[model samples]
Every structure is written in structure tokens, then in C-alpha cells.
Target: MTKTVRIALQGLTCDGCVSSLTTAFMTNPAVESVTVTREPSQATVTYNSAETTPEALCSLVDDAGFEGTVSES
Candidate 1:
């Protein structure tokens, strides 16, 4: 199934952060799309649930040198 995850982010300082994160998420085969917004410090990601999980997605953000937590909203 396809799932959409909204993640609250920390440590994003500029447009470059958005670019880097967007690139990172786009590299994942499981990720269908990614929309990162800096003003609100969040990312809306769509991915295949069978191929990845919300935890793994947060880990990916961490690996990219940022912090992320699954957002309820």
C-alpha cells in the first residue's frame, strides 16, 4: 500500500537543506514523491509501505544529518 508521512524536521538552515533532503528522499526507490517546506520545517513523503516504513524514513533524514520525527498532522 502507498502511505503518506508528514515529518517534522530540525536543523534545516537554508534552501540547500531542502535541496539536500529532497535529493536524499528522491534516491529511495520506495519514495514516490517528496515535498519539503522550510518555513514549517516539515516534509510530506509518499512511499510504498511494503518497501519502507516511517521509522526508516526518519532514519534516512538522520543519516542526512538532520533530525526527523513522524508528525501526527
Candidate 2:
């Protein structure tokens, strides 16, 4: 099954940050889609839950040099 998660992000400054975060999410083969917005400083990611977890996704953002936390909603 696939799962979608909203990750609140920090340290996003420009379009480049968006692109970078998007790329970081896509690097995971289980990721189906990623939408990042600088205005909201968040990313919506869809992925195969069987293959990846929300914690793992957040780690990717952290590895990319940003802070990422799963939204409660």
C-alpha cells in the first residue's frame, strides 16, 4: 500500500531548495511523488509504505541539510 505524508520543513530559501528537496525525496525508489513548496516550507510525499516509512522520508530531508518533521495532520 502507498502512503502520503506531509513533512513540515525548515531552511528552505528559494526555488533551488524546493528542487533540492524534491530530488532528495525522489532518490528513494519507493517514492511515487513529491510536491515541495517554499511558501509553506513543506513537502507532500507519496510512497510505497511497504518499502519506506515516514521516518525514513524525514531522514532524507535531514540528510539534504534541512529539518523535517511529520505533520500531525
Candidate 2 lDDT for residue 32: 100
Span of 10 residues, lowest total lDDT, candidate 2: 38-47
After superposing candidate 2 on the true structure, give the runs of residues whose Cα lies further than 4 Å from its correct spot. none
**What digit string (tens of lDDT, one per residue) describes model 1 on residues 1-73?**
9999999999999999999999999989999999999989999999999999999999999999999999997
Over the stretch 1-73, how does candidate 2's per-residue lDDT look in tens digits? 9989999999999899999999999999999999999878899999999999999999999999999999977
Whole-model lDDT per candidate = 0.97, 0.95
Q: Residue 18: error of model 2 in Å?
A: 0.4
What TM-score, over all chains together, does every model reach? 0.98, 0.97
Clashing pairs in 2: none
Clashing pairs in 1: none
